[model samples]
Target chain A: MARLFKPRMLALAVLAALASRAHAEPAAAPARAEVLHWWTSGGESAAARTLADAFRAAGGTWIDTAVAGSEQARAVAVSRVAGGNPPTAALFNASRQFRDLVDQGQLTALDDVARQGGWDRVMPPAILDAVRVNGHVYAAPVDIHMTAWIWYSKAAFKKAGIAAEPRSVEELFQALDRLRAAGLIPLAHGGQPWQDSIVFRAVLASVGGRDLYLRVFRDRDPRAIESPEFRQVLLTFRRLHGYVDAGSPGRHWNDATGLLVAGRAGVQIMGDWVRAEFSAARQRAGVDYGCLPGLGEHAPYVIQADAFVFPKNRDAATARTQALLATTVTSPAVQVSFSSRKGSLPVRSDVELPSPDPCVALAAALMRDRARQLPNDEMFLTPDQAGAMADVLTAYWNRDMPVETVQKKVVAALRDDL
Target chain B: MRATWAARAALVPVALTALLGYLGSTLWTAQMSVTASRTLPSDHFVGMAQYVRLFSNERWLLSLDNLLLYGVLFISACLLAGSVLAILVDREIAARGWLRQIFLYPYAMSFIATGAVWQWILNPTDGIQAVGRALGFSAFRFDWIVDPDRVLLTIVIATAWQASGFVMAILLAGLSGVDPDLWRAARIDGIPTWRVYTSIVLPQLGYAFATALVLLLTGVVKLYDAVVAMTQGGPGTASEVPTKFIMDHLYGRANLGLASAGAIVLLVTVLALLAPFLYARTRAAASIA
Candidate 1:
């Protein structure tokens, strides 16, 4: 009996040893993390590579899964999570995009990492608010992007005989006329829904002024959407459509930038990401191209941030890797380096920016003014409402729909469950 | 006794697959459609509100309308084009084998790349319009892709180009299966060529035509990639279809309840149209047997 018991005890001992070894952290294994993002564009790719390099330097593995468009990438990530296999981290625009993820308990709360890194003191309130969910940090914001920038080719402006940037809506229209007469596309436009919405928001901020813009988009007030002020903004947005080339429909943002690069188009109202396109074409900022945040000095600068969210998982190794990724993404060096290349500003206002391209530096400076900073519509409205608004805006731009009809439609859409 | 258990064992995989994958998912989706699900399926039931919203949505209504148009046009065109191609190939046409290969080649390429290529060819700037202007025919305008009123027509043309080959292949198989004796008998009867084709050949090819129609119908319902790649349902949602609308709500807008309701509506619509046709076919087969 004693001999039989001895053999059984030996078998149990061996099984315990194997179990401990399976779980015991291998002191030498690198923390491998796979990141999914839409930074596959040439410049965005390089910016992502900067983060990869920093992560590598800190002794971690970086796996990239880049999808071209942000919406496409996010969709793939969400599907992956639903399929029970999610990436270590995924890139998301700083908005209400991850609200569903948090609500479903799919995101790992990054509050511990946020506290450890002193994120509250570094990041601006707006940016922090964008990444926070229910008093917990659910994402690590990487860069801040100003979406309402007017980009123009300096050479085209010179040929058009416009000496300086237009300070008013009327002057801007006159400049467009001069550009048109000079045999260039008055506005380099991509007639995609998002692109049309970006122009509409810029017009909203510049013409409708910030309060009305906020009331309609942020507050989603039906009265504000129905007001004459919103109608005027819509009309101005529609008027700009006339300046666009016939080929604007289905054109890519890069193609629009290409028109500016080749001096075929005079101006483009686009996000600061256009700066990367100019840089890629070997055009110098302030020399070959120029930027205007808005027509007026007090025009609110619309801000959108790109963030990384870690998926919740039970695996200890995966959780540890996620925590590490959250820390690395918000590291000051990574933030500065990524923003410098990405044509966006750093999320943390306290971080000293590296010498960015001239356009990025200007955007960074503009971000410094508190009054100029305004969260993008996604930051306020739910993704559903934002998509509905985009549909309305694009439809109005494409068709000769009456302004009153558009106003009524806008009000009706906003009046749906907020 | 041995055969009974073995047969029952063989049935297990199909049972498991249908129960877990198909029926399970359908039930889950139907449940979620009742709730105000966003991003993920939620248990918060909101009754028939999502269906109400789906019916009220302008884009959704337009998508349904476009799907109907696209369905009728795409299927009929594919059938006609495929039959014509098959008939020509079966005749004493020169280089018949090479022609068959050429017609079938487009199916090998991804629709994403094909759609982009088609977009360029249809664009007003550098496409048919530019070529027309270059040839001194300035009045010629083939920019149906950009014109909102005619964008869906361009999609139809591009989709037909990709799909007609598949239809042709199916019809060609049916054509080959035709007994040579029938043609010889028709020749001896002094029947006209068109009469032989219309009365004899076409009636025999009914099964092939039915198969093509059903396949094309499925393709029409699942038509999302081409629309996304070509126009992205744009020109102010003029070309939006039900599948793309459901997809937009599914992930982009994070409104799964609305998306599910839309899917259920689409499924029910397809079932309503297809059920009687399928039942009639089955009944005819049983009666013939």
Candidate 2:
């Protein structure tokens, strides 16, 4: 009885101490903000630290919660928000990902912050449209990522006797053939579903043209899916699968990029994130490697962005902290620093990169031409629809399905009723 | 004797936790399955729609097929390999402890680590296939990890390697309990050692085999981590399992209603498979009493 009594008394004493310490904290404790993001990789975390530093300089406390994978991070953020203890801010792709949160009144609108920052003038129209839902802004745009870049190893190209960059789909195939003849892996592809869909998007943008791409993805027109042009795009996408090595299945995106960095593979159709890998290997863009936004001169530029949304919080101090974070991340100086380190284009067009990278410069040049600017499918499709479409595309990519059957599957997958 | 009131009072918290935590959440999930829940659960009733969509989903159907194939192969391989290992270890070997540790080491590692190691070993470009080619065997090929039809088999091989060790330990424990007098009697009767093992010793290990089967079956149903660490339901969804499907919908796709329906289906499957075994066990116990 004495032993039990002593431990219980000690536990009560500890609890009393903890409660007193909690009560003793100053009422004006620096407006604390916990930012949830999926940026734990070396370069990505460095980029995220810039935002944390800026927030600290702005007289607010910055708590960083970095989850390793985007899907997992968003899952945690969503569940936390549902569980009623959401972070001060959580990262999301600037797309329909957070549309449900807005519809459910779970996100705090950022109209005041948007107006103060002149977001209407600074942000590109595509990104601005993504953040503004029902005449109120719900997300703060951070960086722009173009998804359909063709990254190739110059060493592999030269060894395969390719003289210049392929400017058309026909020329790209010829280059792939030359690389294969040289006994090299022609395509450095990771066989994950998302990576497979990236290749499909590149093919759709280059082969199907902007109109067909929009019709198939944005409009979800069944006619567009079954058309001969779309079939040709599917055929081209599958044709490139022949160039991949036997070890392509389940290979990670970075490992695939490593192939190009090592000059073992000729080309990889991925997003601008691959630049981080090349740079990590000390390969300079336009020197050791080259990036083409797409195969054709006027191919559609499929763009996506990483942004932050403030989960609805009733606390006045937290609201102020959230607004401060929004303004700090979107400022011109912060945008430039974050984008340069993160291998993405700055969300604000007004910012100037201190030292421009060749690939980013190319993307910036393409961004100015509003005629070629297109939103990636994620911006238009709900998360569920996007996943379903990915399933069809990946199945088609890995299997020997007929083009007509694939078209049927795509139409079914994109049906809004489901 | 009746349990004391103090003991019953002491069990209140645990009893309440079981009733509310497990049973209550299970009921909530069933209710959610019948609603039009997406990113968050809503009260809007949409009966049978999510289940309809789940059944029609090609990925879900393929996942079920893969789970079936994986279940049969993984369980049989683990049982056979475990029995052989237990028999081998039961002999009076000089390095019994070392052999036991060596066989059981993989069970100590997480499925993720085991999956990663096996993935590297089975990769065609730089794994065993490359070594075979390097040794002047130009025609050698073992690229099943990337083949759409054969990727599920690779998962079976990986998970079986991780779980068979555990099954071996169970069987070895059961083997140790076998009567030494029966062995002496068999020796006096001049019965062969292999015959004694097959005809007499194995029959006595029924409870151990049942326990191992239950563990292996649950492992088969929850076969997500190894698949994720290795194939991630790819070479185009060929290695997908039911748990992976439910998880993808639950979080990544934000279709909670469909995910809940999948969970209920998996629960029903497990209950159906375990019912007869549990009933038989109860009957056997009652007869012994």
Tell me, by lDDT, which candidate is best. Answer: 2
Give the whole-model CA lDDT for all candidates, comma-separated: 0.83, 0.86
Q: How far is candidate 1 from the true structure (C-alpha RMSD, Å)?
A: 9.2
Clashing residue pairs in candidate 1 (N, C-alpha, C atoms within 3 angstroms): none
Model 2's chain B yields a TM-score of: 0.95
lDDT of 2 by residue, A50-114 (tens): 99998898888777776556776777778778867778899999998888899999998999999
Predict model 2's lDDT versus the native: 0.86
lDDT of 2 by residue, B225-275 (tens): 888778888898788888888888887788889899999999899999999
Per-prediction TM-score: 0.91, 0.94
- Candidate 2 clash pair list: none
Clash count per candidate: 0, 0
For model 1 chain A, where is the 10-residue window of minimal lDDT? A1-10
B-chain TM-score for every candidate: 0.93, 0.95
